[model samples]
Target: MAEPTTSSRRPGPGAGSPAVTTPALERTRRRFLRRQRARRWLAWRVVLATVVGLAGVVGACWLLFFSQFLSVAGVEVRGTSHLSPEEVVAVAGIPTGEPLARIDLDRVESRVGSLAAVRSVAVSRAWPDEILVEVEERVAIAVVELGGRLRGMDADGVVFRDFAQPPRALPRITTDTVTRREALTEGARVIAALPGSISRSVDHVEVRTVDQISLVLGDGRRVEWGSAEQSGIKARVLPALLQREARTYDVSVPGQPTTK
Candidate 1:
């Protein structure tokens, strides 16, 4: 009280410490702020990149799938023999100017396969502007008369194309009715098993039943082929037996072949 209390309220920290601030501390604070800013910038950059990438992929898909750059322009046929390419293309009915990716390959195959001459078929896009159709045509191994018309028969016993007259090159398949598929199958097998020389000389194949089969040669010679069994042996034995002058040769028992 005598010295007027000398204003002893101890100076505040800022007044006494002269507002001390170290360069190192300032630098550390600045570094921390920089790191936060950097993290935000990096996050923003990653988001932008992801959006751009997605846009690019979507744009590419649109161009390839939806655009007309890859549309079909024409249909091409391959491995066609009896049926013309135009015929196959007509049957396929592939819509021109449609996107290649949009074409249904299975549907095209089924349509082309329905042709009687087609044994097997494949359909595919030939890229750029074409659809390719490949087919295997049925080959006639024998001919059968059905409804007063001669039809070509394949090895599988399928009676396909009808003919005005039986081709001289193919063996005639004589069955009670063309609907007798089993007998026709057996008769086909008998004809298929014959040696080339014998096949060329054969005139007709007679099928009374599945097992009962016979061959009439071009020279009026008859071969009594009881069944398809032992056919390979019979084929081998027949030529040897034919060397002898005989009107009828029984190769049913190939081991004991007899000539009449």
Candidate 2:
């Protein structure tokens, strides 16, 4: 007589659990899915940005170096008086249509400075397409006759240009072909030191040797300058000495000047 056995079996794991989802669990799952999608989008964005940056860099390099946008167009010369602009440009030899950034400015300056008339030169890029060459020409302080031709001599004793006719304003120095270069230099120094007040009265300078220099006035008076030494003192003393009536004035020893 046993009571009807009620067989009871244990439920398997999750077999009988309700098919239910809580709000928090559902929200967590959505967040995880959104995180995965966010990671994928971030990766794509990073790749796109990297590609764009590389393209910009490559484009800039091409424009600066390889392109013809910055090539030289022409050369302009300035501060040139005795030398024509064409002469300076010819000697500069700067190639046209070449890359302006690649031109050697130092070389250009050296070439232009080689001209005897150019005392100094500066070369620079005028940007966009031009090259500028500035030349400083030598200024003649005196004139000399060499080989039957009148030549201009700068203050430094450099004989640069030949004059077709003698300049009436510049004081002429008498030096033959056989005259020593030292004598020419000394004579030039002496002439440069004279003040305009005294120099204007001089007709010509006589250069016998390096130490022997004399200034002959228009009225036939002779000034024994002796040498270039103490020239400043001599220059100052001579102005006062000239006020006296004398055929010859000696300022060789400025402290003990003599007039006869």
Candidate 3:
């Protein structure tokens, strides 16, 4: 009875651990080694790429900042009619042989804009070696005599270039020396409101004060236009009123025009 009890159990598939072959273990080891080598290779590639990229950035910075290859060689002026290129270049003061990127474009524009004729100026780098200055010159819409010389006046009433001889077509404006500057602006405002039909007949404007302004016609006729106020209404009424033969036309009061 004791001998039979010892041998009653039988081994099943789950009774013991499964056997592993040497070939399978070797294959796993090879796979692990291959995975480790691949990870190391990827890491090296990333480091090498980062270093190369940094070196490229540093080289480009050196070329842009320190090398003479991108330095300014000269200044080119454009959009100038009354001002010479040399004049603009001199005023710009862009240092030659300096790095193009280092040139202060805003400073150059400021200096060039100081010229009386320059309305606006733009400065930029002409890549590789030059500075470009673009200027917009003021165009005169009227003329004023100062210091016995006829000076051009723009729509803004800024007295700019001096004419060698008077421009026959341009309307002349006379102002008192004590308040010449202010008077010129008022006169310009008055002229700006007049229609082409009326403006063509105007020979000159006389300003005694800011509000006291008159227009004299080519045929010795006169228009009593007081100040620049209500000029648009006055301009509209003047052409039709001029049809009446009169020595003087008064449109100072647009609603109640008068003639003599």
Higher-ranked by TM-score: 1 or 3: 3
Ranking 1 against 3 by lDDT, winner: 3
Give the residue spans of candidate 3 off by over 4 A: 1-31
Per-residue C-alpha lDDT of model 3 across residues 12-127, encoded as one tens digit per residue: 66849576579989999999999999999999999999999999999989888889999999988999998899988888888899999888888888999999999999999899
TM-score for predicted model 2 compared with the true structure: 0.78
After superposing all C-alphas onto the true structure, candidate 2 shows an RMSD in angstroms of: 4.5
lDDT of 3 at 104: 83
Best by lDDT: 2
Looking at model 3, the pairs that clash are: none
lDDT of 1 by residue, 1-260 (tens): 47655665867777456766899999999999999999999999999999999999998777657889988899989998778899999999998888888899999999998998999998988888799998999999999887788999887777778888778899998877533668888787788788899999999988888777889999999999977777899999999899999999999888999999
How would you encode candidate 2's per-residue C-alpha lDDT over 1-260 as one tens digit per residue? Answer: 88888769866568776667899999999999999999999999999999999999898677655678988899999998889999999999998888887889999988988899989999999988899998889998889998888999988888899999878789999966678998999999999999998888889999988888999998999999998999999999998899999999999889999999
Q: Any runs in candidate 2 off by more than 4 Å, and if so which?
A: 1-65
- The true-versus-predicted C-alpha distance at residue 212 of model 1, in Å, is 1.4
TM-scores vs. true structure, each candidate:
0.78, 0.78, 0.83
The weakest ten consecutive residues by lDDT in model 1 span: 1-10
